[model samples]
Target: ILHPISVLEEEDDEAVIEKYSGSCLAGVSPKLPPLPPKILVEKVAPAPVLLSMEDEEVVRAVVSGSIPSYSLE
Candidate 1:
């Protein structure tokens, strides 16, 4: 489920650029079903690694109320 939110503060007369890079409506063509757009050309990039000696301590601190709500998770 997705919802789109637009700002109403901008006037309606303002022009907006709508460039369609074949992302949203690329794969629904009946004739082009076999050759759909190559949305992803390669495998997804790996996630960044979190490294720190106090990583476990930080989590424990958050769970034990030793830190504030936005401290760590």
Candidate 2:
């Protein structure tokens, strides 16, 4: 005995469902105005030079007082 073979009737029978189970996303930063050249310059005071106990106390006192101003001001 022989049984009839079943066939798919759709025209695009070869089209298979591709399941992508993952996130598709991207990050976008706001369009910011052009920054000044010096904006990126971090004004870090130079590391204090190693000094003797007396000198360290003096230097600490100096830094604790008013910050020095440039003559350009």
Model 2 lDDT tens row, 1-73: 2233344466232432222212333354678999777656678998978789986766666677643434214
What tens-digit string does per-residue lDDT give for candidate 1 at 9-70?
66342432242223465456666446666686777889998858697777777788998867
* Residue 59 error, candidate 1, Å: 2.1
Q: Number of the top candidate by lDDT?
A: 1
Overall local distance difference test of candidate 2: 0.52
The global Cα lDDT (0 to 1) of model 1 is 0.59
C-alpha displacement of 29 in model 1, angstroms?
Answer: 18
Tell me the spans in candidate 2 whose CA falls farther than 4 Å from its real position.
Answer: 1-49, 66-73
Q: For candidate 1, what is the TM-score?
A: 0.28
